[model samples]
Every structure is written in C-alpha cells, then in structure tokens.
Target: MDKKEISHSELKALIGKSPDLLLIDVRTKEEVDKGKIPGSIHMPVDSVDRDLALDPAAFQAKFGVQKPSLDAPELVFHCQMGRRGALAVEKAQALGFTKARNYAGGYKEWSEKAGK
Candidate 1:
C-alpha cells in the first residue's frame, strides 16, 4: 500500500515506458476540456470513491476501459494541482490498488514542464 508521489520527469518517463500504467485524471470536466495528458482516463476526484466501489467488470464497462487489477504495476492519478491527485491515490489504494501513486506535478505542472 505504498502511496508514492511521482515527479514530473518520472511520470514522463513512465508514460514512455509503461503502457500498462493506469493514468487517472481527477480534474473537472470543464478543466479537462482545456486539455489533458494524452492517455489519461478521466475520473474526476469527486467520483473516485464511488467508482472504486463498483465491481471490476462493471467499473470497466462504465469507464469503457480495463479495470486495473489489484497488483497492477502502477495506478497514477492527477488533477489541476497535486491535492486531488493525492486523495485519489489514497482512495485507489484503499480499494486495493497496491501500486497507486500521485503525480504531484499535475496538469498545470505537466503543461508547464512537458508542454502538455
């Protein structure tokens, strides 16, 4: 149950190397409309707790994506800033996502450093 804080550079490298990583964006729909990390799944922070409670198959169907197994290598979450990301990581881990991590440098920082 390690909730690590992933740095911007580390996240970028991860994106390049780990296709299995589950990148969850916890930003609002309005905020997300501006732009988001290329492959991130949109799961706003407010909905995380509820969504994590759904059965795996149901969750996957609802999200239109594969549900991360409990032992999935990495389940990273992020928002406009780091706060919601951290919370989402906690919620994911609580729901048994062993490799949950927060991308502390969220969309704002990502856009600033990684040019979106």
Candidate 2:
C-alpha cells in the first residue's frame, strides 16, 4: 500500500499537534522496557492485524488519536530501526488511515536525540 513517510525530524515536529496524531511503537514490550519516547503507544507489528480485526475502535483509542476529532488519525510508526516501521506504515495505510508515516530511523534516532 502507498503511504506518506516522514523523517525523524518531521515526526518530532508533528507530535502534540492535533486530532489523531498517533505515535505507534512497533517494538515488543520487552524492547520498550529498555525505554520509549515519551507519549508513544506500544503496538507491536506482529499483533497489529489481529488486534485491529477484533476491535479497531479499542485499538485505535488506546494507541491512536482521531484526527480532526473522530476522523482519520495521523500515525507515526517506529521500530528498533526502520524495517518494521515501514511494514507497520504499510499496514496502517491498508487499514484506511490516510496519514500514516514511517519513522525511518525509529528508536535509535530517538535515543540519539535524547542523549543530545
């Protein structure tokens, strides 16, 4: 599926802006246990399809914010690096979200920024 991918800097800027700007971390809880970017929601890529199928609303609510209020949510998906994030972004777009973006550098970039 086609998607609009955003860089790390672009994503950092987009955070806390509006409606359904969701920060979706595609790493496992164990990985996240190491640390996660503040305000990010955990939704491992493996479970996304099933979870979305069972209860899209609940999944979206806990992990996503509705864009423009109950409208399409902007998604920023990340992983250890960028591979999984790209997959997640594709999945999100297939699910009908128009604003999904892949955080190509993922947590590594996040950690680097935090160090700075």
User: What does candidate 1's lDDT look like per residue over 3-40, in tens digits?
Assistant: 47888887888885887878999999999999999889
Best model number under TM-score:
1
Q: What lDDT score is found at residue 15 in candidate 2?
A: 77
Candidate 2 to truth, TM: 0.79
Clashes (backbone N, CA, C under 3 Å), per candidate, total 0, 3
Off by over 4 Å in 2: 1-3, 54-57, 60-73
Per-residue lDDT tens digits of candidate 2, residues 1-116?
44467777777777776544677789999999999977788889997665545465775576564322223456678898899988886786677655677888889988998799
Error of model 2, residue 36, in angstroms:
0.5
